[model samples]
Target chain A: MTPRSVLVAILAGRPNAGKTSLLMHLTGSPQRPINFAGTSVERVESRVVVEGTELQVVDLPGIGSLSALTRDEQEAIGFLQNRAAQGSERTVLCVVLDAVKLSVELRLLAQLSGLGLPLLVALTKNDVARASGRPVDATELERCLGVPVLEVNALTGAGVAALRQAILRRAETGRPMPLDIDPAAVAARVQPGSAAPARSLTDRIDAVLLHPLLGLPAVGLVLLAVFQLLFTGADPLIKLIEAGQAALAAWTVQQVPAGALQSLLVDGLIKGLGAILAFVPQIVLLMTLVTVLEASGYMARAAFVLDRALSSVGLSGRSFVSLVSSFACAVPGILSTRIIDNERDRLATIAVAPLMSCSARLPVYVLLIGAFFPPRYAALVLLLLYGLGIALAALVAGVLRRTLLRGGHSALLMELPEYQRPSRRVVVGQVWTALREFLVRAGTVIFAASLVVWLLSYYPRPAHIHAHYEARRAEVVAADPTAQKAALLELDRQEQAAYLEQSYLARAGKALQPVFAPAGFDWRITVGILAAFPARELIIPTLGILYSVGEVAADSYELGSLAQPGASGEGLRARLRSAVDAQGRPVFSTLTALALMVFFALCSQCMGTLATIGRETRSLRWPIFTFTYMTALAWVCAVLVFQIGSALGLGPART
Target chain B: MSHQETTLDCLPPGAVASVVRVEGEDQIARRLGDLGFWAGTLVEVVRRAPLGDPTQYGLRGYRLALRRVEARRVVVRPGQVP
Candidate 1:
């Protein structure tokens, strides 16, 4: 196939204008970042094939105007103006305007009309506008603006095909129509019969949502519902996936000949990928909830609700959205901070964003809590961990703002967009996009990390140990079938434990164990924590490997089974429970688990989040600062928790 | 003489005012201008946040919340005597 030449079609609009939805609908591609060839600036682009011509649909950050002050807005303008300077041929501007807020939207449109690029107006939210008794006449708008104004409802795919064709046509032969209008004068002309009401339905909704007495509690209830829906909706699917993965891993091990390939497929690839993909359901649900909240305009109201409290911590209400998103994962959370206009405020938000206990930390938390705490207290413990994350984030933000990024007090001068029912298509598309991202990362980074981990745990050439297990397995084969199977399992477990103890990873963990002693960590726990540096979720599988608990799926792995006595008359947990140092003191305790939880909650362990911080800030300094400070904070906090708990004799020796 | 000008932060809830001037020539002021808080634009303090530091203002056919510090930058004149 001949490579199609790419034409750049820039999609620009005000915040909440459905620009991203249009881009997704037009291209039918999940949102992917396109590094502009040879430029430092990168924007999300989808390769769109339109009428036998390939068009690169670049979705620029939403900006209010060309004179925008935020870095994101400036980048949007720079992308457009650079093309405009190069003579605007191969470039077309698709300006999406929210039909209900045409006056404000048109003001931005007016500024961009001077850019001298062929512009097509996508007047979105037609359904909402009509339902609210305010509809923009596309013909009238077209005639007034001297451009093809397409009335598009992104939700229903109305005018979407026509809009795509329009883009192609504009790219082919259209010229810049330099038409400008005084927004204030034209604002009154667009509304035909009824005057623009100062108190719209949004105000009434905000009355309740932003109310002093009910707003906070309403927000709390909404948050509870969001998480409840996420957990309940995703639990069954997670269980199903975990079971399938385990069964597949066992089947693959049995079917494949005993070789490195089988070990790689079963131990490294399957286990690693399964560990990562298992979180997809929860992540999808989270993206869906966030999309619904955002599209319905509740997110802005949430910012309004949180403005005062955030201000006390030197953050504006704008940081609320970013912080909330960080709970799911920090990459998108940092990306979402583009909405905050103030530079210092945005940086401060990004710096503390990873402390929000992202979903990557969820597996570790669940596994540890399930193992150490009772089932009845699971929900409360999880809530407390999440709450601790948020509290620490706020405290860190305050300190960072006061020291590193200090400046004028933050202002909450942001628009409260009119409430509209979230589009089902948009929410589905967002979830799909999030799931694709998760799978891609699992297929790449986690896959590689898992392979390395599997290799390290399988090495050091313990030939004698393998021979010994084989002899024992032959002897056990003479016994009954059940005894033979149990004997083989025990031999496998001993072989793995013996190999791991002599591996390079074990040596490194032992070397670092003393440093983590104050934090109540043993060599194995230190190894788990070290392995998690690439991604927080890796700690669970790492622990499974370190303890000879092979191929354990995080969601379904029974702690009781791991702790159950085997042929050696002791399980992994039993070994952990009885482990001691040179001084004959127990290595693991309840206090240690709590300290580890606190450490995971505070540490910047995920490489993706750190890389995202670097990309978003366009500097390595911030990411370095973020990693160093967060790690230091985690160490100190974990040490303090352990020391205090040990001093008070808070936890029993072994329950 | 200046029509008893007061900062937007001081305007009690439900009081309408027309912006007389934006205080600074900084980016914050320019952004406020971009958001339609320029001179002669009518604004009202619709409500205050729970802790009362940031106040929601109804202006230019939409509702926006501005902190007291940001609101202080906008000089306004009371629109009507109640």
Candidate 2:
């Protein structure tokens, strides 16, 4: 077998024309659905082998015309211009067209064809068009445009193989060739015949969907359904993932002897990463639902319904999709900001996007609330925390838009593509792509971060400490079988406590304690906060480790009175309830918990989100600005919550 | 009918018009043209947003939403006779 040169096949089309779906079908690559206008802000590449020929498919962002309107369109045009100038024999232009909107696509096709390239047109969505009794005549189109036109259904792989062969043949031809037909004359003959207008089914649907009175309620219901699917539908899958991780951890523990490597794998890497990985199901579900919404044409309608309210806060309607996705996880949410047309609006949206309470924060919030507050109040408290994040985000977005990101004239002129049945294949492809990307991107950062935290909590063990732990274990093993279990647990607790106290994390926490004192946090709370900056979910496992050493067993004591140990002793919650500061006042008071909740809700703690913002902006200025502002806001809000709550004498155990 | 010219935002819902010009001598006009709102194109106000600020309009076989601030920049002549 000989090596083949990579031939660049550029897939260009107007917005929402099934170009991405065609790409997925042609290359068998899982493509993410970005249905709204301007979402394809960058070029994506996929490699495929056809007849032993290597083809590098470059899917340029969708554009309305080669003339260019928004920044995204300009980018696509610029790429084409650059490629055209190179005059490389390796380049092949494949213009994708929506069969139902053939005339509209012809305008762009004509412009692209004028670039003097070996042009081939892929007429997509032929299934939908045929169902509507308006299937495009590929032969007529080819005769008119003087280019090879192939009808393709990306959903079912119809005509896909032939299209691939066509591309291979064109690349082999290896030269730019202008069409023999005149574009102006061809467009004039094919443009939906000016005498009779095509009244699409989309118009009938839009009559109710875009209705002033009915649209709002319908839009709200659609949004509610999406959120319900993301949160409730994904719950069981998340539990299953967590259970799997736990089983893996148990297996690892059974296989390895008690040593540093065992602890590192089981405690540092597994537990730490497992806590973060548990949210993948929710993110995948959100992306799938968003893709479906976009493909069905409702996403644009949703944006139209939301345009007024969003613009009031200095954001365009495009920010609605990105902001809502942030509730699942900020990394994908930040990436979705590509749909926003204006650079200033895009940056502003990215800046305040992380303020949405992500799934990562849910674990920490639930752990703290369940430990401190009653079970009956869980729903209300969770609602309040999410609401607080949203309110602060809106306020911050407004401020940023009026100041740093100011100066651009906001516009909302965007096309609402015709509605069609979302392909099941595309939806599945989207979910798979989102899951894989999240695992590769955010998952690695968290794994490394967990290892660093594990190292901090596991070093500098003195020989005497080891000797003391072994002696205690020996005494427990020799005792009566009835007391052996409890004695062994107590001995483990003592050993863990001693080891933790001498570790570097403890020293760092003690040094940072004074800085967090105003927010009512002690050294232990400070340690959790410091560790959680890399990944918000780390706080829960961090607290579990910290309290397991100093406290008794799990969930064995009452909430308020930590001193009253049950028959099996107390858990981490009881230990937290009974914890004390230097002045002997109990920590984890109701006020302090509220203060910490406020801090986590507002802070830019997730390294994944920051990294995404840097990648999207292609600059560090925005991420730095986001981090600095968010941290400042979090600190100020926490201080206020603590100070005011203390003044009012609130909390379970007031100092 | 009076020979009068008005911005697109002033047209009542359900009214039809033809775009006479895009007012701004800037990229906004060019962008509006690129989005199929060029001069001589037929346009009609389909509906307004719930808050009555951004209105949806049908043009060139598609629907688009334009806030009052942006709509005011497009000059249109009412198709109806007085």
Candidate 3:
């Protein structure tokens, strides 16, 4: 089959001009984000078949003018200039103009006209403009600007079909006409009868939402609701995913004979992939809420309210959205930093975003806090850990601004767009895109890392150890037939634990144990920490495997049982509690647990976050710098916690 | 009518003004002008942020938020409240 020739349509507009909504209407569903060549600036691209001709629509990043200031704006201008340089035969520039703000938006239209590309204006928000008593006539605008104009209401799908037809037609035969024009004059000409402006719905909404006394609290409530949804609302779904994964692994084990392939499938691939898949629910929920907030125009208002507070930490209000989102996951949070215009501010926000204590760290915290602290103090310690992350993030951002990323001012010049109902199509499309990106990462980098860790812990099974275990199993089976099953299972567990103790991973952990000695981590803890590099939540399962508690989900009630003082159960938490060192002393004291939690709170343990940082910045230096600084800080803080706690006599037997 | 010339940040909420000129050649000033703070353009001080630094201004039928540092760069002639 011959490939259909595709026509190109580039959507351009200033921020908050309803360009995105218009693009959503034109491209039905599913827009893919593609970075412009050689730069990190991403533009959403979609392919649509309009009247038998396939059309490729590219939504450029919003820009104020052709004379660009920020990197993203420069990239947009560069893309247009390059397209213009190439003889514009199959390309049409669709400029989205906000009808309510015709004069300001027309300025961009006039500037774009200078490019001499075939142009069409998509006039959006015409309904709102008309309700405000200053409606713009599309035909009059077409006559005034000497280009095709279509009145479009993106919310209700008004005039979308005509716009699509115009786009295709213009791409084929439209000619570039270089006509110098004044934007204000043209706007005035088009709107011949202007009435006094009535109080807008946006004004009434803002009067309450943006009020000085009530605005901050309202913003707080909104963020708190989002946080609550991410934190606990998705818990049941995450548990369901984990349960399904465990069931699949169990079913596989029962079907396949015990061998290397079975172990690899059940223990390595399925478990590793499931650990990430479990997060899909949280990611989808976060992306959906963020999209809603952004599309409803409430995000900008939130930023405006919080700008003063964030500016004290060398970040603008824009960074608040990214940082808050980091509390769910740092990968998406870092991606969201593109909203910030200042390069230095964006970079700084990206640098410290992971310190917001993402949901993945909750399992590790819960396990440790349950195993060590009393039930009464568990909540306090958890709160302290969260607070530690935020405090350190602020400190790091401030220090970075003063030193490495110095001299760039965080300019807070942003448009506070009028509130509008978020379009369902756009929200769903964005959520789907975020989910796909996350799953791709899980399938590639995380899958590979999981296998490597599995190999390291599975290899070099000496013949002597197997022989000894086999002999022990034979004696148990021979001595008592009735109790053989129970005895054999214990022997099998011990055999696996012994084999792991002698594996290459354990050897490396032992060799590096001295490095973590100040932080009170033994070889077993070291191995868990090392294996958790791929993803932070992997530490729970890694600890489970290392301690010979068998495979266990992170949120299993067995782990939670450790919090009860008089509870009786043989879980990973209990195993960790009773674990001993060479001197017959307990391996984990309360101080040690505190130090470990502190380390994990500050450490750069998640490879996904680092990889995202590299991709977002388009440089290896920033990620490397972030990894080094965070690790060093984590180590120092861990050492301090251990030393201080020990000096205060908070030892193993105290609790 | 004679009007008092002042920086944009000086106008109280609900005060109307006409932009005299944006006073700098830097990127911030250029961006301000691009957002429709040109000479003779009417602008109104809508409100200030809760912490009282960045203020919202209405111009060209849209609202914008600018910090005091950026707003202070735009010279304006203040008029009576609408």
Candidate 4:
């Protein structure tokens, strides 16, 4: 094919003009999620080769007549405003207009026309206009706006090539028939010399979404609904996975000989993988809610509602999106810090991100709450944990804002996106992406961690005892006489557990007890915490392994923890539960659970989050600092929680 | 020099100046529409919010937010704010 034109055309448009959607339609790449160099907010850039010309297309953040209401807006305006300063008279300013909403867009057309520069109007959503029976005569619209109007349907990618041809024609020719702009008409709306308009649509949206009287409650209810959906919707999926795990375990035990291989198959792979897999439901549900809210423009509305409060704590209200996601996973939540530009505010945000009580903590909380707190109060207790997390995060942010990272406050200046029903396809797309990412982590990182923990809990059997216990014991022991059989079984159980006592994870847990003894953590709790760092969901499986019940390992550890462990006997299980602590009370008390929750809430425990931070920041310093301080804070908080909780008669007294 | 950072809404309309300095928490100022204090670029105080938190201003044909305390930091020449 012959080259139609070799040219570089910069696609320009006002915001909400379907620039991004069109880019996606054309490029077929997810470049729409690229982060701005300094800002965490993503920018959409698409490259398309049309008839041999590779056009570098940028979806510039919308401009209001090259004027803005915020600093980021100014930066966007600068690129458009810089055409004359660059000593170039031919930067193609392709202003996009919605065919159906011509009146509102015409005002921008008039204002953009005054620049006395090259410009084109790509009339977008032509399909919607046509389907609504509004025939947009391109010539008449062009005459009315005094600019070239090209009809294009972003959904179908039709007329895009024609749009490119128009761009090429304009670029080759200096002035493509200047739009008929009367400065007087445009100047009437703007102040005589300033960009201040009499009123803005954003101001109207703010009146409703950010109203002091109604905004906060509205935001709370929205969040409550999101959490409720997560809890309610994830039930079926979680049950299905749990039932699958049980069936697999039963099948493995029946098929294999009653020996080491059967026990290992049932306990190691199936249990570990199943445990991590269970929480996928919560992650998927939470992400879907966030995607819908964000797409519907409520996320920005939330920023406005929380703007002043966040400013006082040295956080931008924009940080709310990241914090909301932190409720699902703090790892991606921290990586979202690219949105916050200031160093101090970023640090404060990072410190508090773990406080959002992410999904990894959900399974642990659900189990503990279901077991300990009454059903009527379970949700309230859950909310209380979330509330406590929010309060602690705010407190820490306040202190950091005032001290270590004093910052200039941020005022809310965000685009109030026009209200549209969030696309179901988009929400589903986002949820699928998040679920895939979560499973990928579970399969690789969590899978590996589970193996190490299981191994540590397995080997080093006392006095060279090996060759698979059930097999060897059957051959070597005398035929079952009641007294001898009981003695041998007890010896075998003790020897198997002793192997755990001697393993590295066990040794490390034992070594940390003195440090955790004040927090009411025995060696068992320390090992649980250790396993939980790679992922908080692992706490359940870690406990399972510590208790010799680690089924599905830490894989289903979070949401799947309540499943029956293999090789279970009611009497033996209760005996294990009643194991004595150094304080001569039963270990795993209510206070320990409370302390563990606090630690989970306060500590920056996810390795994936740390790795993401390192990737986003392109350095090790911030993530390292983040993980260290949050961990220290977690330890101190956990200790204080236990001490205070015990004194208040919250734990051990229940027995 | 200790730069002045004024809330954006408080700045009177029609004052022209250049952004000479910017100070406040980086993230906060950024959220409130505070770009860096580059050497060149016209800045103008445009409008104040009715609720008196974020004030809007025009700079280089764009409007952005500035809390009351941060607007004073621009340290601009008198001709740009308007």
True interface contacts reproduced, per candidate: 0.53, 0.39, 0.62, 0.07
Model 3, residue A489: C-alpha shift (Å): 1.4
- lDDT by residue (tens digit), candidate 3, A1-655: 6577788899999877777677787888678877755444566898788767888889887889888766668778988987888868788999999888888888888889889889999998888888887889888888888788998887888899999999987887756887677776777777643211235899899999999999999998998899777866787788788889988998999999987788799868997888678778888898899989998999999999999988898888999888877887888888788778689989999999989988778878878877777888987998899999999999999999999999776798888888888989878977787777667644367777878888888888898999999999888878898978877887888888888888888888999999998888889999888888788777777777677787653543332444555454337767888888877778897888888888899998887788888888989999999999998999999999987877777755422
lDDT by residue for model 1 over A1-655, one digit each (tens)? 8777678888899888888778878888777766774457767788878766898898888897777667788788888887788888888899998877677677788888899998889999866667767666778778777788888877667788888888888877757767778665565566442223355677778878888899889888998898778656876777777788888988997899976789789877887777666767677777788888988999888888888888778777888878877777776677778778678889989998999987778767766665566566766877888888888888988998888888854666778888888867668766666566555543366567667877876567568877887887877886665657766886787677777777777888889989898898889898888778767877766676666765454433332322332323233444455666557777667678789999999998877677678778989999999999999999999999999997898643632
> All candidates' lDDT scores?
0.77, 0.76, 0.83, 0.62
- The RMSD (Cα, Å) of candidate 2 is 4.6
Q: Which 10-residue window in model 3 chain B sums to the lowest lDDT?
A: B73-82
Error of 2 at A5 (Å): 6.1
Q: Which portions of model 3 miss their true places by more than 4 Å?
A: A1-3, A33-42, A192-198, A441-443, A553-570, A653-655, B80-82
lDDT value, residue A314 of candidate 4: 75
* Cα distance off (Å), candidate 3, residue A597: 1.5
True lDDT of residue B53, candidate 2: 71
How high is the DockQ of candidate 1?
A: 0.54
Ranking by lDDT: 3, 1, 2, 4
Compared with the real two-chain complex, what DockQ does model 4 have?
A: 0.09
First chain TM-score for all predictions = 0.87, 0.89, 0.94, 0.73
Residue-by-residue lDDT tens digits, candidate 2, A1-655: 7987678788998887777777777888655333223333446667788766787777777887666555577778888887777775778899998765554566677678778677799988766666655555678778876677888876677898999889888776656556555432453455443212246678789888877789899988987788777766877777677678878888998999988999899878787778567778889888888888888888888888888888889887888888888889888887777667777888888998999998888766765666666667766877898999989888998998888888887777777877878888767865676676567667777777778878988887767998988987887777775678877877787787778767888889989889888888888888888778678877765676677644223233222222233334335656677777668878788788888988999988877788778777888998898899999998899989998888888854653
Residue-level lDDT tens digits of model 1 in B11-63: 89988888888999887887787777756677878888777767888766567
User: How does each model score on TM-score?
Assistant: 0.89, 0.89, 0.95, 0.70
